[model samples]
Target: MFNNNKLALAIFLAVSGASLSGCGGGGGSSSNNNTTSSEPTWTAGVFEPSSEFKDQCALPRTGNDPYNNNQPYPDTAGSEFTEKMWLRSWSDETYLWYDEIEDNNPDNFSSVAAYFDQLKTFERTDSGAYKDQFHFTRPTEEYFQESQSGVVSGYGINWAFISNVPPRELRVAYLEDDSPAANVGLQRGDTILMVDDISIDTNTQQGVNILNEALFGPTAGDSHNFVIRSNDGTEKSFTLVAGNIAQTPVQNVDTLTTENGTKVGYMQFNSFLSIAQPELISAVNKFKANNIDELVIDLRYNGGGLLALSSQLAYMVAGPANTSDYFYYQTIENDKQPKSDPYPFIDFEIDYSNFEATNTSLPDLNLSTVYILSTDNTCSASEALINGLKGIDTEVVLIGGKTCGKPYGFTPTHNCATTYYSIQLTGVNYKGFGEYSDGLVPSPSPQFAADVKGCELDDDFNHQLGDNDEALLSAALYHIENNTCPIVVESSSAKQPSFTSQAIQETGLPLTIKQPLYKNNMDLTRPLPAKEGNNE
Candidate 1:
């Protein structure tokens, strides 16, 4: 589902009983037009087919789309009510938890986005977290730019927010090679003190807006100044200009010789983008050539991308002998459509840039067991890889904290130039298991299928990733050699310099920087099941 080529997607969609929507450019209409006494009223449960109101935009776009071969815009003149109704029907039809959603009157909502936001089920998981936390929307332009192009306008730095209170703590998590942050010598664990003269710990909403915009804002060539404190208590300043950064999905591929003379392959895999196909193939081939006795993949920061790429990696690890069956089975809304075909473990190399098979047999390590370095940031397709391999009895030893719980995915359906993502499908492994909504954890004796055997270690930012001394990677190596998890104790005297200011609250919003909903969710690009004689 992570293809970047639009022409290829168009051909597939044409034959797959679906038509592409929202390819043109236009913003949402400002006409709220609240329901008046003379206006038509609707019952809560009563609905129409989403196609009835599809592309009926309040402010229809003009002119042909330059991105889509100058195709005419599909939008037609309508009201916000029509747009909202389209979203409501779409949710009722496609949402995985449609029964749990509260049917609200579309006329009561003011805008399409507001109504779309409330369309998701408000149910929570047993862990007290929202069951459907991945619901969101983005302009079609923005979605395609990031998803299709795999290019983002940023400083090439992934920030880790330890806290987000008055005494907020932000640190440099990692950087892309030749990135603005890496070019300026910013290393992991360096605490950010100020951004463009605004203190990171500032309590004012205005200050928060400025800080967020300067750090996460999406605009090329936008310059911002930053002040950071190093791990050794050294203060430094830098000016970074944002640019289009194409991420190096795979990095730090190396074969490490353990103290016991066992060869282990280690690589820091950042994302599952299309560009990852060739890189991953190269890395696996190197490992295979080196005759690595074991493999350790650093996925602590990989928020996942394409499912195909994930399946490809799994095939390389397990090989065709073990992966001759379905990788996973996708289940959609009950009775809405027929059961989908199982995702097979891909064995041939794919030019994911165009979603085509290269016809070349993938190099396999034939490893029965693999060590995966993970954290809360590891999610979606990354988790799918773990579940897929485990389905075939492959031992996936997870090292580090629990993964970000996400077993659900959706097909990005666009309408009115806005790409809306709602939970539509729940994928399970060949073993018919996918209930890890609370997240997969590491325990000596895992009670549930989601739990794996490994150690729960803290992410050590003191050392560079893929380094021999790094915490998570080191734990994996030690586990391989000793056949047991090691007990790691931290030095008491080592403390990061905190902001010299008063704290507003005892805690902060969250530990990690908030990523876009797309980054954390799986995308389904294969043909979805449609009703008989109906194309979705």
Candidate 2:
């Protein structure tokens, strides 16, 4: 969701110096004795079109046509004209609409124009502010504004800075199948060196801009050269032609496994889009059919999607009755009471009874443990799933890197123009006993660097760890085989408080609390704490 305060701030910056005018002026040119002055010709008030004006404005114009002329004015020209109109409308009353403005007259044009100019400036500044706030890069000609569905498809060309091991490189974390980069063989984890001819030394806005310029433009189909460093440390150059690429948000069941003679099911959730529910259900059912003893959910690169889906997945894994208990939510009270001596401050408890009553009901798998693989790419809806699962007493052993730390979500709203935009606001904080605003920390497991030289003789060596490495998987299996769930006895003084499930529902807070699991495993506690050679 877009932040309203941020938008307001942008507007303030954009129109800081603008002046306000009020009421009535002559519409026609009038002679003034003062050589330096001329009569104003517009009026003030909100620009509400008259029925006649609406009829004319609503009609679609064709072939480079402008409303005032046969040819459409350039962007720069139109902006200048709009500013002039705003000034005139603010000064003259005649410019104000008869029905819209309360104090209508000829000289109100200047006020109206001033307001309009301020509005435009506000819009421009807001756009800039939005980009900066989200660390988003401006889209170039090669970049296309994808439909909402496209974003869900796991193919959205959105890029975010992520830390990689050993010389952290600004890599392509997500690539849609239909995107030009994907078409040209760009894959997640591919280290980008140069776009067009510009080198990417820093993962800053400027670096992203260079990428946009190289990959997107009016001449989209034109070929451009890219220098990249593959995961295996080999550098290669490729000439790619830019084009529209389809994104796939969800990936179906890839494989299933059994650990310690116990059936272990594995499925990679690539995205949290609308289509993910059915796919997930099918995967889970298949695992059940296979009598899987454990499940490994890979969300290392899942960037997140619909909140409904996250809840739905939680219900499927942890059961309906437990959903509310497993997640945290709160309501914001805008009204503030004035401070006084011994002023009483009350924080109201939010009731989540309605949520529990409406969502789908399902039984918790109640597996011994759920192995969740995560990385910096896991965000939003993905984080929600993790938070929700942990809230319900489900054993989730996080493996891999710390999450991207995106707890907020957004809902889109449309304005007078059909052009819709999203407002990003903090809705709920999913504190599951462990307050996780810092980031989702993973548990330590076995770590290994591939010994490629040992398997070079095999032709399939290149494809073995082509996509995801097996180190994390191997570690999970190792623990399952050799280690029992580590139990820690707390001192009597350190005894924790436990609340009933009902209490959790009423308060929107989890009952059970525990310290960070770092004591059991150090490596998994905090992103393998930057080693001298590690790049991530």
Candidate 3:
């Protein structure tokens, strides 16, 4: 089922390459030169009229058709085969023709088999070649079964038996209606334990494999036995059928509250998908109505989505007038002119000319301070949003771990038949004050250190913090409480100064005089070294 070339094409386009041309001269004939202007022809290989191109191109004629004069042999089959053979002979010629064609462009070649053939001819070494190979193959049933069994075992779950987690202490995230999970009674925050007879182990890859087995069956309506631990701690067993699930990206909120009685607003942006802009505006309006004093945008796990959504969020936080204040930068290799100074890089400036505030009712929250909850998983659009916020002088207090270092974005292109590729041809480097590329590293202060140490001592470390503690959040809270903002200190100065030196500098008790009190033994208080000359 995964062998469908169209689906493969979609996946290929998600992460995909570039093209260049070279010329060679023919030794003997002007005929070769004349042929170059015309579309290149193809020759059929041993795999002619294979199942791969049956749907797209014509196949071997079997039955009589009126279009072909009621003959067993059809002209369409012959014509298609002739075209296929011509395409095979000079692949570049096919591409050239594809470029010239309006509807049947070469870029829209969406066949896996066609791409394979092209790769064999061009010998391209792009990453797409590897991914294409991986996706085209069909796995054996024995291989799949063993793989699933291995995953279940790794999770410390017995493949032949059922087990359950103790109830009442589990957190649940609900699967939406019509989802494979929803049909199985997998409500929001349902504490899952076992699928069929196998128990789940959180630390093992097998756990994920088992879930996939149950969730993605061979066909729709596939059922799986589930053992669940509900919120009330009751152990129950049920059967769930698999089906399609619609997933929306944005989660909105109207208001939040800080520890110091501060009424904060929140917008938990999960992704920059198609529905993000409208949802965000609606959420903002609700916050304005509620008189929110602060805004906390949680992007702790947003890995990114559409770039347009990122721009919209940036405009909302940074205001419409200051769109050009920041720019995203990237480095590109200019092979023709390799120089000593630097490579020619490009900068993509966020255009705010069309950003219109649909709701003029601005909230009570301080636009100068935007609390951004980040983490290592926060990447792409998340980074863009934070950078955009900073561009307009919004106090973007990033609260969490360092961001995922993936500032580069991609644009999609056609590779071959039914196969598309997304190439990371451009890089986004935010230019302006607080623009960063190494990612937002949390600067954990003394107080943050203390809180983490305390958590460790109490054995209450929350795994929800993932790899890093919520040090950035602590910094933001500190700023709100003490009215001191956190600054991005460079890596060179990450280490704190020595306590002895700090104490001496602060107290000024034992002063170390570097120079003589009076030079040349001049009259007492004579002009004081002309002011500028006094280094101290």
Candidate 4:
């Protein structure tokens, strides 16, 4: 869809002395003719398999090479695996076109993280946001284990820096059941007065860094102290040790009763993972049983995972309109077309989220309209869901902050130990549209231009999220009843540091893409459940 060309073609043709161009949308690499673009702020992100790829991409599965998982680790193992995988996946499979210089020179790395920096495929965006910000990687083992098992090890406090400037306060967003935070009586809307005896705030760089380490840098059995304030204005302190946290993606499922007896189902879908299917099914089935008139999907903190789940969730919401209709078309560079596939609404039984579960279809909500609660973290597959729903002409109401726009996604490929996640796919809806890097902002523009379905209203943080009276949910409820938006009344504009919810920051990793790996025995020829273009 863009004019940028010569990425994938540059690799193969360079050996043969020929030149070629790229195809499709979103990820196609454009020229880097700018005189100055800052060095990329790349970091290690988590790993998951891609549903659209079958190639090993890294060191050969049968090889005795150190870079291969079968062999012993080399001091240079990660770089070698990263280089090869970059050739197989990043260079060849990326939806974005690459320049000849960046395409052929893959040896510029002393570490895996450094190697990751060189694989980014966009010209520098100057407004302090990544026009092409989908680059990210993570420790392979940790991410793979967590994504597959729905578990993580940490303080278990889902906290957010709600203010951007001085005195940046950390507030509890929610708590995982049985987590350290939850065990210590910490709950949503609580304020963390101190972390590790270091007065935590966003005002100073040292404080934020210390807070980051205290929050995510520790292993199980590690302990940190925090002074917390309850909603009733009582303050207390506790020393909590870290432990393994089991994160259930569907955190809350309840029905809200309006004064007029209208039943609205509310579900806080945290992330898209294996556990999500069962949890989501359980919630939706209950909503269905209750005969819910409207549904509110709270994806405010969902960073996106598993394309299959995204498709499943979309189908569950749209039902018959989705049935045989196309959900998303995943496209790669021209050279790797064989690995590409289409994800339809009604998919055959394929293993998803590291488990082979029963049934191919998710229980459908079958609603004509869906209300989505969002934030900067509502990205990748979440945004893809919004795209898929809109493409099928389903009514989607977007409330809260603008969505973290990421039309791209990745499957974490690996060498030996380090899994390499390159931006290997650009997803489009049935009509084939995928160019929303800035994000699907909530605005009142035309459908295709403004991106999200409904009018814009910033989230209300006066109450905890998922509460019947929370800002975002209240807006959705308000709109559902009145058929118009509540006014964006003046409130504190400062927000905590959020990924995908806010612009690219110098202090954090850009978490723009993540999704499921292709099932090993996936049948590319699986037929649509209904006729093509049967949205009618």
Candidate 5:
């Protein structure tokens, strides 16, 4: 339950000359006092309940809400202190590793967002990476704009960092069709030599910041010049203006025939966005109609989106018999309310517009195995698909690099016009295994049952995705026919810049430059019907 008090009762009551009855969480008399001692104080390791500060804002937005059909913003009068206190209490109660957090005094920090950033655990993974790398926040309206409308301001390029460190190599992994980048003839494997005038390989901090902004942080109608070296080693300059681009979640849907006459269904899935629901359904329907022997989902660049979409995709891959059991079980902190039931494989369609269930039964392929083209970019919900399928005894042959190890998720929490996404839950499969924090590797000799079976090969950028000749796809095809991974031959093309696995692993923050806060996540905010019984 949420302490949702109207703004009128909390803020307008003062102007209306009405007696306040503790409406805005102790804002009646104590909050109205000008005395310094009356202000809320913070003691190290001590916290007041978050509800006491919920909806309290220092600079609350007034007037009609442009994002919500001219509705009033649900913000009340408070201070920055109350906002920080809310974050501390909420995070303490719900953060998956609340006990591991260092309870620093919130007053020590200058800004609310800055203080909220320090609340996560400073622990490391086995590979020395931050245990909670997914902690971040976004402007509430910006987060909803992308999640709901699937529109973003960009050049429509998914930039791949072969190396984010100096001698930094940035290349175009893929492009949304009809976008500025595609319209300018930018193709996959085209390395960006320069953004504006800053060289992509610049080692200076100022240059890196400039490069990051030029490539990732652009507004609509912004123009910049780029020097690109194509796969054929031809360099050219082009001016691209950023615009509002709607993402194409699913693309290159086709059925490929191997030399042995085995039909394989392949589709490049970029994001698990709400806009992807119908596209995914239709792709599966086509695959089912074609009676494809195997399915290959290219998620090398899919950061992740809604969890319900992940469940739906898993169901479609494994079909009813395999998905009758639980798909995933999420565990929250014990201090929070009772946990919900394990999410089962979604069999029916969902109207993502309103997040309501539909009578339309989803299409399924009933395949026992699926080939997933992965990379470190294959994160949260994408990894969920692999783990969920493996839980139900379906084979997930991962070709290419290891997945971004994130079995974590959170319900996006809103406070003071900012939506904070902290790790609230860690999800495990029906087998009770979710410890792949380092990442799920493509191994020929899988050490654990959850370790995927396939080859650890480099991402093939020289060839277009869905082409049978692409390294990852070709490897999947080879494994399908030969029942074993083929020997990986290093490509000699300069477009396929070689980087050590360690370098790639260490480039986590830099790699996420193109992807914003909400892009890489298993958002637990999707509405699902309550199914009876815990499948666990």
Candidate 6:
């Protein structure tokens, strides 16, 4: 039964339902868990569209989700009480549009933790059962708090290891403006040689995990010593106190004139938190002032967050070119209503920082086309941004590798002590295209990829992301010059495929970076108001 209203979700728990299990970040779409959905063929000669996935969700029946008092929850046992509460919430609210809940039973599971573990095998993820439902209760209150406000506790360093290989060299990717790393003058390109006198690299497999723990310990405010090597090869050792640092979703922004005299704007927006809307507006405003000839958004590592901001960014990029066009469409399993609903370009002036009720006219760049930098980590709302732009016929030139392939989205529901995010809806562009379960690959074939300009380039570790000559950024600049890809390289010096990125095998290792932020607060059922004033 496909039902997701708040009341229905509650009644179901009194039934069970679900989203993606992700690593290093929190997202409803989960990461690196796509199992190829086998396109099922029907003997009846019925033509099935890409939207339906039967072969992909075929998982060997493990067990079904318990909806009733199938398991005796001793009232005396606090664990049972907690487990029951969780199970009920899962049953009540999980979005079963992709895969039905009762399909797998959890009767054999002995404990609530074990039941929860066994229960997520049924998400419809379209990639097959590889999409394990990412439903977990927080053991601590901090996680619950972070869900609502999008705030996190950590040293606020966005560092990436030099490589996944042992004897790894840790480098600072970028730092939050007010993070401890920034306060200590740790700039990008600085390498960490030691953590509290312990070497940053290890000779064994556990080396990375061990180094990670030291860098990101269990508690904030923990002081650790470090020796960092500057870009000039100068080594300086200093002590850094890891404390609660506010994460800045808008990581980097710059506007510059390229060597060819083309005005280009560059931004590396990592997440789409509510705070990002204003920051994004600020970035676009700068580009507007500069009259950028081309814009580059480096989302090579972004796992995505809010869709509202993603929509706004799309609108900002496409500007007047797509003023009346639809950014994307929402589709549900139940067909009682229309086939799909259009979410038009909302260019409202909104104070996303405060989640204000009122709306204002959003600033627009009005560029007819855009160049985006991506990798396997670019996902959900990020993918939506790419598709949304494509929907309006904006020229989308993709540089770097393929994206995380997630048109899936979710709205978080809070229970006793945990927040459950189930994949309630999937998005399609204005053309009614949605299923990129295998991800949108950049190629000449419009059937297999997004129909726009693009190149498959790797990231350059030697240069900064927004640098004029960076691997992905360079391709964008080249596209502006020759309108084609630069000669593809064997690989970038910064391309460390075997490193700790999820692009490597999902080894379930702890990461020094903060977990992903995923949420979309837009009221999907309602259509956006028409553009104000100037119809032109």
Q: Best lDDT goes to which candidate? A: 5
Ranking by lDDT: 5, 1, 4, 6, 2, 3
- How big is the RMSD of model 2? 18.5
Q: Is candidate 1 or 5 superior in TM-score?
A: 5
RMSD to true structure for each model, in Å: 7.4, 18.5, 21.8, 10.6, 8.0, 11.6
Candidate 2 per-residue lDDT over residues 460-500, each given as its tens digit: 11221213335445445544555432232333432112233
lDDT of 5 by residue, 415-480 (tens): 879988888777788787788888899999899754799899888888999888998999999999
lDDT of each: 0.74, 0.39, 0.37, 0.59, 0.77, 0.57
Give me the overall lDDT of model 4: 0.59
Q: What lDDT does model 6 reach?
A: 0.57
TM-score of 3: 0.48
Which tens-of-lDDT digit does each residue in 1-536 have in candidate 4? 11111101000000011122232111212212321132111122311233222332233233344323446433221224333333334444443544422432223334435545555554643345655455445555565566557777777766555653334456777778778778778878787777787765444657766766776566788888878888789999988898878887797798988877789999998777656767887898899999999999998877777666676678888886554535444444435455444555643233442233334456777888899988776777788778888778788888877876666655554444455455545667776777776678776555555466566665555587677777788888888898778786665663545433343354433221122121110011122233223333
Residue-wise C-alpha lDDT for candidate 1, range 1-536, written one tens digit per residue: 22122111111000001122322322233444332223223456776798987887777778996555689888877667778778878888888888877776554455677778778777789878778777877788776776666677798888765555656777777888888888889998898999889888776667877887888874788999999999899999989999988778799999999989999999999888776778999999899889999999998888777776777789999987787644544444446856665676766666544555554778898889999999888888888888888888999999998988888777788887888888887788888888888788987678877798888877777788888999888889999999798888867743332322233334432222444346775777644222223221
Q: Whose TM-score is greatest here? A: 5
lDDT of 3: 0.37
Give candidate 1 regions above 4 Å deviation.
1-41, 490-516, 528-536
Which candidate, 2 or 3, would have the higher lDDT against the true structure? 2
Candidates 3 and 4, the one with greater lDDT: 4
Question: Which candidate, 4 or 5, would have the higher lDDT against the true structure?
Answer: 5
- Per-residue lDDT for 4 in model 6? 13
Clash pairs for candidate 5: none
What lDDT tens digits, residue by residue, belong to model 6 across residues 456-481? 76656567667777777888888888
- Superposed by TM-score, candidate 3 places the C-alpha of residue 461 at a distance from the truth, in angstroms, of 12
Q: Which stretches of candidate 6 lie over 4 Å from their true place?
A: 1-93, 97-114, 122-129, 132-150, 161-170, 191-193, 197-210, 228-235, 325-327, 333-340, 351-357, 444-447, 450-452, 491-494, 499-514, 517-536
TM-score of 1: 0.87
